[model samples]
Target: MKILLVDDEESLLRTVQLGWPEPDDEIVTARSFEEAKRSLLPGRAGDFDCIILDLQLPDASGTTILSEVRKRTDTPVIMLSAWGDTQFRADTLMSGADDYIMKPVGIRELHARTLKAALLHRKRSSPKPSVIAIGNCEFHVQAQLLKGETHTTKLTGAEASLLEELALANGEPVLRTDLYLKVFQREAQFGDKSLETYVSRLRRLLNEHTEDGAAAIRTIRGVGYRLVA
Candidate 1:
């Protein structure tokens, strides 16, 4: 795996580079947001399997760098911060970060989380049915588009990822926790309604594009959700 490490702390960067668990993995380091942007140039952002970004940078806030990364690619980003505030963690998670870790982290734990995030990203992005039919609507997974008999709708990355999981499950019920981990790359937390929000969005889209009751997303109560085609 190719990983990008962005932090102004020279010592932490050096430690991560040397202590990376996988001997075959390549590590790229950038000390500031500008340097990170240079490394993520137009043709190069997709080269990274995962990014370990510092919450505090010398020139720009980590959120700024995160926005830049999201604009370029959906590469898994794990934010590292010394700040332990709950709001900071929530804000980053809501802003598309795959994972957030408190600073003074152990190399082994970091490596594990990093690998999990990358793996989940790969799984979400893996090839599936390019187009799925739901009633009169056709969901183009690769294109992130939904075409109905009358109108079309585009899906956000998170929405598309959620749909992919349900499509892959066919008619079977997928666990909520499993979806949270696979889709969000983190465990579900109390009061975190992101999954519900995506599901609601999909429900609305399905309702808009399909005949009444032609297709539906069923909540499995204690389990999770399933798609009824």
Candidate 2:
């Protein structure tokens, strides 16, 4: 089974991976929002049997990303937060989080909850359609496909998620925080290079097919990026 772990602390991530005694499971770590989004995109929802989300992200707040995920996929998500108040718990659960875990939590409990949520989601969820059109390109949400007028290419799950967000923005520049949270599904934090790497790969895959297509993804100085119409 594949597990997506979203957190910013490198040590915690290392601890989770090394501490997990499960011999047959894969634990992938995402240090920020963008990284999570890549792992949790619609078509790739089944890529991870379970998701462990951190609540105190630098970019996103409340259950915005959680709501977004519910719209596209039914993958089980367990939200982890430092705040352990009853109010917070009520808010998150009502907002659609499958489960809420407090910080300084026991690894054993976390694992148990993750397993339970995964099982429940798999049994209860059904398939949903996911597709988007960006200018001349058509994006298949679940298939990670991008078809353009003259060329077509298969995108990685992360690439497809990022492209979908950009396409939905419709030529406007999207905030780095929003893109990171929306695509990676975590906060945009310092020293996280995943977003840049994905964008470069996206530009290469998406622009190489057409004349001057490289200009389509424009850098917005100190902001984020804007997709050309």
Clashing residue pairs in all predictions, respectively, total 0, 10
What is candidate 1's lDDT per residue for 76-144, written digit by digit as tens?
Answer: 999999885776676678788988999889999999999987876787678767899887888898999
In order, candidate lDDTs are 0.87, 0.75
How does model 1 score by TM-score? Answer: 0.63
Residues 1-229 of candidate 2: C-alpha lDDT, one tens digit per residue: 6898888878888888888867688998888777778877768866778878888667775376677777877677889888867666755766677778888887778788888667655543544346665556666777888778877788877787787667656577877865776677665667998888988887776666555556778889889998874
The candidate 1 region of ten consecutive residues with least summed lDDT is 210-219
* Per-model TM against the reference: 0.63, 0.52
The candidate maximizing lDDT is 1
Where does candidate 2 have its weakest 10-residue lDDT segment?
A: 120-129
What is the alpha-carbon lDDT of model 2 when measured against the actual structure?
0.75
